[model samples]
Structure formats: C-alpha cells, structure tokens
Target chain A: MKALALGILAALILLTAPGSQALAAEASEAPGAKPLAVGTAFPDVPLIGPVSPELADSLGIPQNGPTPIAKVKAEALIVEIFSMYCPFCQRDTPTVNELAALIDKRGLAGRVKIIGIGAGNSDTEVDIFRKKFKVPFALFSDATFAVHSAVGQVGTPYYYVLKKTPQGFTIVAAHLGLIHSPADFLADVVAKAGL
Target chain B: MRRIVPLLTLAALLWIAPAMAADPIPGGLAGNIYPVPTLPPTDSQLAVAVGSPMPDFDLPTITGGRVKLSDYLGKKNLVITFVPAAWTPVCSGQWPGYNIARDIFEDNDAALIGITLDNIPTLYAWTRQMGDLWFPVASDFWPHGGLAQKLGILRSDGVSERALFLVDKKGVIRFIDVHDINARPDLGPLLEAMAKVHAEK
Candidate 1:
C-alpha cells in the first residue's frame, strides 16, 4: 500500500510540475489557427448585425445601411465580437470603454475604428443596449451570429486588430481576454499600428 | 550511526479518520480564476450592494421595466443567477434548481432574476417551457454577453459561466459563488450560505 501511494504521488507531482499538460495543450493549437498574436494577418471578417435577419427578403429587416461591414473603416480596425447578455462581455465593457477613450485621446480614434459586433441578440435589444452602455464605438447587430461564425470569434470582446496592407487588411494583433489594463493596451496597439 | 525514525511524520498525514468524517462538500479554492476588487455591501461577486448603486448598464427586466442595477435598491434583495446558456445539461439542472429555491427567497423578501446570453425571446420561451414560476429571466442578448463578461465570468465560448449571487436589501452583494464552467452549483451550500446571510443582524 505504501509503495502504491508513493508511486501515485510521484506521478502526480511530475505530471503537474513544469513541462507537462500545459505544454501539450499549447502544442496542439491548429497550425493555421491565429493565436490572437501580434502581426498575424487578420482576414476581412464579414459581419451582419441586423437582428434576426432572414433568408427571405420579406423579413423587412433593413435593406440598406452598408450591410454592417462598412463600419470597419480607417487603416486600422479593432473588431470585437460581443453579446449584450453575456456577463463576461459586460464585465469587459469598462476595459473596452477605456480602450475607446484612449483612442480618442491619442487622436487615433479616426485612424483606428472600434466596431462592436453584437451577436445572439435582437435588433431592438442591440440598439437599446448600444445607447445604454454609451458605447462610443460603432455597434452593429449580428442576428444569427453570422459575423461570429464568419470571423470564428469564440466569444465576446474576441478582439482582432487589422491594419490595411497591400493585398488587403492584415491582422496586427488579437487578444483573448481583458488582460492588459485597457488604457495601456490600446495605447500600445495604436503605437504599433503607427496610427 | 543508526537512528530510528519517529512515527509522527507518517501519522501526521495518515489521519484518515478526519478525511472519512469530512463532508463531501467542496471547500474554497486555490487561485481564483476570476478576481474582482473587494467591495463592501455585497457578500458575493455575483451580487452587487443593494442601494450601493448598481453598475452602469441599461439591462431590461423580464417584467415591464427597463432597469439599471440601482433600480432594485431598497425594495428587496436580488438573487442574480448567471449561467452559461440555456439547454445545456448543468444549466438545465441549475435553472430548475433556482425555481425550486423560489420559496426560500420569497420567505426572505427577495426577488429572483436569471440572466443569460440568450435573446429575450429565447429566455421567455425557455422559461415558459421549463415551467419556471414567478422568477424573471432577463436577456443580456444584444450585447451578446455584456453582463457575464463584465462580471469576469464569461467563458471563452462567449457564454456566461455558471455563477450565483445574493444581493441584500442594501444592494450589497451578500453571497457569491462561481464554479467550474462544467460543474453544477451546490444548492445545499447555496441555501446554507443564504441562511447564514439572513441570520445576520
């Protein structure tokens, strides 16, 4: 019994120590899968934020208004996928708001547009929420998660920064969570983008 | 030189009697995945201090009113239960569990609220289908997951992870419990936590 216990303990300690499961998980990321890393080329992510958009034209959703993709203007774009009801997205608002404020402060707001792509929500819900949260950034609604599916954003504030390149818009950076204090990160992105 | 080792080293850890006697209930955790600045007035991170001024968001109530967190102040304690999404296993079990706890909150002069990333229509339909009673299920839908993400409980998949909170009459978060995304919360522990809070002066 004692031998069995010590063997199990040793295995556990060794497995949990550095150079174990964590490394395996990192190694397993898909080859083409963008790490939300710096300098990765961001694809031209298509988006449709109209709430509950339908396959048939009779749905009476807006026929115009740039199809929601035009909002990603300027040389650099910070696109965030979000849903109003998501608590994590809501929690990250202050950080997002701070990012917007930083852009405005640095005069990079014009050069780097912040587009909020809201999915899994209704148009009315998105509109009401947009005004409520005081999201100074452009807020678009993706009714059936079309944009979310297109960009393959896993969750809200799945941030992807894109800068205009010769071929098209190339991704500059992608951050997974609300880590870096909002202001500092936004400033760094703007500086990196040279905007 | 030969020395006999004392039995204390083995005995100290071989105390299986206590282990066998301990309840199965889990204890507090190691590193917290979600960290928030400690604020007075609320016990749990899930609940905010009543009357302490709710956070800024124009979330709509299931009932007819548009409310900020401040609107519920001074009237009654708010029970905010945030789950990942509807129709999932743990959440299906969790929502019904809250429905079961309605009586307890009613006795405590509180209101029960459920928030999720599902659209209002989906929330309404799910609530009705699940046979939930007087509880209100709010949709944080448009922002997709504005609330849970802000609460630091949003999972990588854009859904709100399971989290529960009890806000007292003063709008202070009284009971907060966040669990592993896959795990269902313990109703018994939640009840005990609420009871302890209610018993407080």
Candidate 2:
C-alpha cells in the first residue's frame, strides 16, 4: 500500500511538474479545424430551442418549430457559443448581459439580434444559466454538439457575427475568449457586421 | 551497474507517459470519454446510512486551506458531497451546476463541501475550470481516500462514490444519498432535504 501511495505521488508530481505544462500549451495552440471565414455564406443550420414568442416575433419566425439562421429578419446576428460549465463563460456572464443591453442601449436591437448556443449543455443546464444570470436573450441546448460542429466551434465562449446580404448571410467575424469590454466589443461587432 | 541503466530508462519512459498524454484541460466539456457507472442501489456495504454522525475530518482543500467537518457544527448545516472523480462527464457537470446554486444552500442555512480522492493540484485544475465554486473542495488524497473510506463510500478504484450527506447543525447526519455514479443527482431532492433539516430544528 505504501508503495502504491508513493507511485501515485510520483505520478502526480510528474504530471503537474512545471516542465509538463508544454503539453497543455501545445494543445491549446493547436490550430482548430478551419473556421468559416469572412465573406463565406452562412450554412442553413436549424437552431433547436423553445424560441420564445418575443424572439420569434423579432426574428420574423412563426411561434412554432425550430428557427433557421436563414429566416432571421435582422440585419446582423451574433451567435455566442458557450457552455454553462465553462469558467470563462461564467465569468463573462455579466459582460454578455451587458452586451445584450448594449444592443438595446444603442438602438441596434432591431437590426442586430443575439442568441447563444449552449454547446454540450442540456436544456436544463442552459435554463439554469439563464435564470442565474437573468439573461434576457434566448439560449438553446446543443446536447449533441450539432450546432457546435456546424459552426466549426473550437471552444466555449466563442462567437460568430453574421451579416445579412441580398444573396445570403455572410460571415462577418469570429471571436474567441471573453469580450474585454462591452462597449469595445459592441463597437467591433458593429464595425465588422457593417451595421 | 550496467543492468541499472535500462531499468532507469524504463522508469523515465513510464514517468513521461502520463505527462505527455495529459488532457489539455483537466475537467471541462471536451475530449472526455469515460463511461458512466450504472446507478447503484441505495443500501450498500460501502455506505454510511442516515441518522449517523458524520466523522470529523480535516482535509486539505484545492484552494489552499484545510476544512474540518466539526467547524460548522453549531454555526450552519453542512452538506458533504463526494464525486467519483474530477474529469468524468457526469461529475464535471455536477459541481458547475452547484456553483450557481449557492443561494439555495444559503437560504437553507447550509454550507457545502465537496470531497474527492484527487490530489490538490488535480482538484485545483479541475475546479478551476468549474468557475467560482464557493464551497471548499477537499482532497482526501494523503491517506488515499481516508475520509471516504471511513464513510464507506470509497470505491474499490480508490475514488469516492457520488454520495451526499446532509448534517444538521447538531452534527448528526440527517439525509444520505449514494446516488448513481453516472447520473447527476437532482437538485430538488437536495433542496428538499435541506428544507426538512431546517424545519425539524
């Protein structure tokens, strides 16, 4: 038993030693699967959610089944890929809430709509985040990771800004990590979406 | 002396293997694939039944402190939660869900302490990803599952079972749930248990 304990202690020290951090660094720096770039047409992916009546009305979607990205009447869309369990996402909750408010504060709510896909979270978990944060925006469950894969998501707290065009919606920007500031992030999104 | 060289080389390779294959993120939403355990029956040879006094423990926490079970005896109700491991799927979701439910416990005048067999560094990396878990996450590592073994909830694999013990202000265990290792315990029952503990006192 003492030998086993020693073995585990050795394993712990060996695994967590400062020199071993390179493994984590390498994996984090690994290039993600190619993301959808600017000017590329947005693929028609059905967003699965309870689509609130208000959101449906705003998106020009009927209060019925899933809403498709192509059907949104807004000039621009911000789809935040998040996970309820992500620390960064949890820390950024207030910032995201601020961003949501900024759209209304800037009078961009009608032209720019925002929603979130809870990657790897169940509906119940997403609802927990919504209630805990008092988030005003709709959040959808992506338990099967379909939405994450469709959007080429690399990690949680990712974002994709899409702009509506005469032909179809095109990718405007992709962002990773927390938004440094609500005003600056809003300004960047607004500039990128050309709205 | 010549034969010692190859043995030393083998030991070096063995040491390097785990570090090289370490998960980029210790406990999070991606690149994890451990099969969930089937839900076990409530009664077991490896469980501390309700109505028992919880054994006092002073274990090291991931956040650089030691927590004792007796510390909250008169001040607040205590909920001791044991998860199977840090990086498993169900366990990963369990604490993060609890992170946002601090108000529920506060309302019930209860304090939560999470215990796992994982060492401090492993627990630190795991809970760091979980986001603002207000509770103390104790590591029952030095004696290898010491406290968990005392509670009879330590699995043969050297990890604790997914168990919850609610101890009242008097330090008597009020409710116990040795839940299915694979499933996240419903918060409703826990809240109900806390409410019951408060009503009785």
Candidate 3:
C-alpha cells in the first residue's frame, strides 16, 4: 500500500508541474542541437554556390557534373560562402583580403583557391562587392543554396577549408567571425592542414 | 581676480558635467535582463550596449535603392531593429510593435528601419504574408547577415538574433536591446526612449 501511494504521488507531481512541457521541450532539444564543429567530415551532399549559375553559363564548370570544385581538388580549398549584402562580410572582406595577400606572399595563391559563393542573389551583386572589396577571386553563385543547406551553416562570412586526402575531402576548419586577427586565423588553418 | 576665478570655475563645471554623465549600459545578455554598469567590459560575447554607437552600415535596399547608416539618421534620432528571419512568430509580434510606433517616430522627427537577412523578395512576401504594412523592412539578404555580424549580433548558425537599437542623429547610439532567439524586445522600453528623445534637452 505504501509503495503504491508513492508511485501515485510521483505520477501526480509529474502531471501537475508548472512549465513541465517547456522543460520537456528543452530536454528533447538539447541533445538534438547539432554540435558538429571543426573536423566533422562535412556532409557529402551536393551544394549549390551563390554564383554557380554564372559559372555554368560562362565557363561550363562541372559541365553538368555532379560536384563543383570536386570532392578532391587541391591540398585544401579555402571557401568563403557569402551573400553580397551581409554586413559582417563587408567588414570581414578587408580582413580576408589581408589573409589572401599573406597567402600570396607565401606563394600559396593558386594552390589555395580562396573562393566565395553567393547565397540566393544574382551574379552581378556578388561581382559588384568583389570589386568593391577588391577580393580578386571570382564569387561562385549557389542558385539553390544547396551547399549552405548541406553544411547547415547559414551565416555569411562562414568559411570552410576542406583538405583532400587518400580518404576523401574533409573539412579541416570552419569559422564564422569578425575574426580576432589575420595571423590567428592563419595559425588555426595551418595547424589543422599544415603550412 | 578672485571674482573672475569663480565665474571661470562655474563655466568649467558646466561644460564638464554632462560629459561625465554615465550612459546606462544594458546587461542581461545570454539570458538575464538587467542593466550592467557600462558597455561590455570585454568583447568576448557578441553583444552591444544601449548607448554605444550603433554599428555602421551601407547597403542596397530591396527596391534597388541604396540605404546608408547616415541617410536615416533622423534630424532628431533613429531606431534600427533586426529580426531573425521573416515569417517567424515572435518577430511577427515584434515588428508590428515598430509599425504601431511609426506615427510617434515621425512626430518626433525620428525614423525606424527593420533589417534582416531575408532577401527583398522574401521580405516583401513575408510582410504581405503576415499582413505587415507600416515600416520599411530592409534586406540584409545578399551579404547574408553582414551588418548584424559586424554589430556582433549574428548567430554562429545562420539566422539573426532579434535586436533593437536607438541611435541619435549625432551617430551616437542611445539604446540597444539584443535578445536571445526566443525573447522579444518590450515595446514599453522603446516608447519610454522615444519620449526621452522628444523631451526638451
């Protein structure tokens, strides 16, 4: 009789608790919150660049091929997924241009294709910003945002450096920032994929 | 010489006191909502204070027009509000709050602009989708949260964290309220700020 009473008391407490549903919702959400940080072999799903259409129309890139830039290309690719009007990216570009200069100074320019992909905008907007920021690299247009969708990273100026190895192209590092400094950024990138 | 000295001292005191006036810095970032002593002592977290200068911006508007941080710096003051994405619930409630205050903003020679990462097409569709018609909803779409990111208000993932900023015509920020994804900016505080801006200086 005592045990049955305690069980009944427990059931009543659970049923009548204030904000219980919200607590349960939080409990259910915490674990599901994706913590896929650096080194998580970025999903293999095909992604659309912000400017892929312009490239396809202009250069016949991928030539209707499955992967753009390929799952395997260089030692590593420094990809900047951006939208033309992203305010943080505007601030970040000057910083990114500095890093690009350092990479050029280090003779890693072509080897490290510092690329930009436009998210859901016309090719022209991306081009205008590229000129405004003087970011020498061509911005890829992701007409569908498939790439942004696959990575589940939606922030502009979100950067990903993927290194191709005998295994496959895997993400070395990714950051969304007003980066602390250019050297610190390079250090993190170099540490992961080697200078 | 002695009488001249007191007059000089009084003039100096008058000039120095207002600059010493401590602007109330807001606290309660991350979750709690209280006023902190000053602008964040550290930049570790992506938060801005109420009276700090609103981070600057120059971007293309939805209708092929250009918008600058300075153009709308109203003759009196300005309010800049950022919403996470269009078509969300709390934003639905929050944006309309700005709309309802439109008349008061105009009367005081103040202006309000709502900014977000959603493109103009999406912004237009969503506003109409939700039947929001009062204030201008500016798009931060192409550059993808760039303005918010500079302000340290963009989330690590993609969507923006809801925020509202009141900037004076002098380009000095007078009010800032950045909320977590779920929290909403209380319209009462904004109404109070508007009142203060209109109050005779």
Ranking by lDDT: 2, 3, 1
> Residue-wise lDDT of candidate 3 within B35-107, one digit each (tens)?
2222221222464666577678876655567668778665658788887776554454455334434566787
| Candidate 1 error regions (>4 Å) | A1-41, A47-71, B1-201
Query: What local lDDT score does residue A50 receive in model 1, on the 0 to 100 scale?
Result: 45
For model 3, the stretches where C-alpha displacement exceeds 4 angstroms are A1-35, A45-66, B1-201
Report candidate 3's interface RMSD in Å.
Answer: 28.5
Q: Write down the TM-score of every candidate.
A: 0.42, 0.64, 0.40
**Docking band of candidate 3:** incorrect
Better of 1 and 3 by TM-score: 1
DockQ of 1: 0.01
Error of 3 at A9 (Å): 63
Candidate 2 C-alpha lDDT tens digits along A1-195:
455556556656766675565433211111244567777987877777676799778878766546677888889888888877665677677988999999999999999888888876766667778888888887877777677778775566777888899876788888776776889888888899887
Candidate 3, residue B149: Cα displacement in angstroms equals: 34
Return whichever of 1 and 2 wins on DockQ: 2
How well docked is model 2, in DockQ terms? 0.14
Q: Which segments of candidate 2 are over 4 A away from where they belong?
A: A1-56, A60-71, A143-146, A165-170, A191-194, B1-58, B62-77, B84-97, B120-133, B150-153, B161-201
Fnat, 2 decimals, each candidate? 0.00, 0.12, 0.00
Q: Where does the lowest 10-residue lDDT sum fall in candidate 1 chain B?
A: B26-35
